[model samples]
Target: MTNTADHGRVRDSYDVVAQEYRDRIGGELAHKPVDRALLGAVVEAAAGGPVADLGCGPGHVAGWLTAHGAEVVGIDLSPAMVEIARREHPGAEFREGDLLRLPATDGEFAAAVALYSVIHLDPAELAPAFTELRRVLRPSGSLLVSFHIGTEVRRLDEWWGHEVDVDFHFLQPDVVAGLLTGAGFTVEARLEREPLPEEAETRRCYLLARRD
Candidate 1:
């Protein structure tokens, strides 16, 4: 899908599901201890720099970033989510924006993150998304992405019996790393973890990369 159309569809989906998304998604499971650990490790490795929480639904990750002392901005395609994020996390900044078309300038970010966000984009579309990510990042900028570790497209299905049409294109770790490399990001660390019982899936990964 073209970026414009893809973004529009994403906005529509999120907006259509906003209330249910917020009500049904998230918890100790959604925001897990492992996330804290991963963030701690990344922050320590960050050496103090700003981070952009791309596709940051309801600003949960942005809240975590603020608590951890990282300058952060949470951007999402849905204005409703942004509003909720701002209302819930009063101090944090939440913007209505598309990840594939960032409003940030080049070298403005020290790091970019998409926690369980990129799965919405298929592999063919990843290069451009990664390219857009590369555009806003400073040279050697850190990129951390997390997603369900799997093969094949997890098509629109009844997620928790909601019957919502959500598209997920899961990739093996190697393919993700390759996309980062292809986008001029050097892989710093790549990890796979078994999901907690409460999670939708038992396997996910964190890929830490540096723009070259």
Candidate 2:
């Protein structure tokens, strides 16, 4: 499911294209109303405690949380991405860390968000990542996860004219819910939406849950 090879590939791929990716996607929320609304709700549920934005690419979402009155820390697998995040959001904490083995102790965060962060993982690896997410949150802490909805792993050979190795795994919403349930999370809401004009055509899903 999760191998060091794939993880290294992901980190290296992102490192190679961090700047272009940041320039392209940093303003994405401005055109995504649904995402902004859901993220606002997540911040509110977090209630001012430290929130972990797992796989927080470039720290845009973490910046949004900070703008909305939440204390946030952004984590990513790519050091280049983390550097960009730190430059973009000086007020928020940014660190390089893996989702399967976060650099935090148990019950370290009050809430967590993983927006399309698990897309690189195979289905078998998702449980371990979810368990790691649970391990970092306090009891009853909230979690908001989003992902592409479908059954496909889009293997991207090149991005922005740069060669890269990455696979994006799209999952069914119900399957994701089952994964959360098995990881000791209580599913509170399931949301799905069609993509915007600037986005991929695939449907997107959001799941709000709480640690049990």
Candidate 3:
């Protein structure tokens, strides 16, 4: 179960750092060839259908998808983040929403991407989150998720000089895959990579799944 208080903290923290976060991480895809490649695959899989960028901070991922010919909607928990995303990436739609209970209709998207976004969720919340993702996706829709690979929770009291509270929960790929499977998604592909020099020193895991 997702703690409402924790969710509020996460939202507030992101709201506090929304601008700085966008300035720093907005253009990250330019340096990540693998991430760009996977995102391209997502665009192709969508076949011009609308794609959902879940946990889309500043709308960078959604913007990239829109630039690549996919219709996109970006969803974030922070209203400030959504505002920045809308202002920065006018081509894609941005909305303030939670992962556990998305503000979208059932089967509303042909594909969805949740890059490094699920890390904010508690381990027990993963199943429900994935189930919600599946609920919003069309049958056989593609889903891509990425997160830090570990079994630890890293809490932050401050970010970019702003006082805040947030917890980033590292996860095991196998456990995530199992949770996805239990949520009615079929695991398709998995990739693990070392962090780039500019990124935090942690291994990252990406999982591609299809709604069934």
TM-score of each: 0.89, 0.98, 0.99
Per-model tally of clashing residue pairs: 1, 0, 0
The full ranking of all candidates by TM-score, starting with the best, is 3, 2, 1
Q: How accurate is candidate 2 locally (lDDT)?
A: 0.92
Q: lDDT, candidate 1, residue 146?
A: 92
Candidate achieving the largest TM-score: 3
Per-residue accuracy of model 2 over 44-116 as CA lDDT, tens digit each: 8888889999999999999999999989999999999999999999889998899999988899999999999
Q: Write the per-residue lDDT of candidate 1 for residues 1-212, one digit (tens) a residue.
A: 36566566667677666766766664443457877787776666556777888997877778777788887878888888888788776766778877677878788888878888888875678888898999988887888899887786766645445445567777788988998899899999988888777667648989999899
Ten-residue stretch with the least lDDT total in model 1 = 156-165
lDDT of 2 at 119: 91
lDDT of 1: 0.78
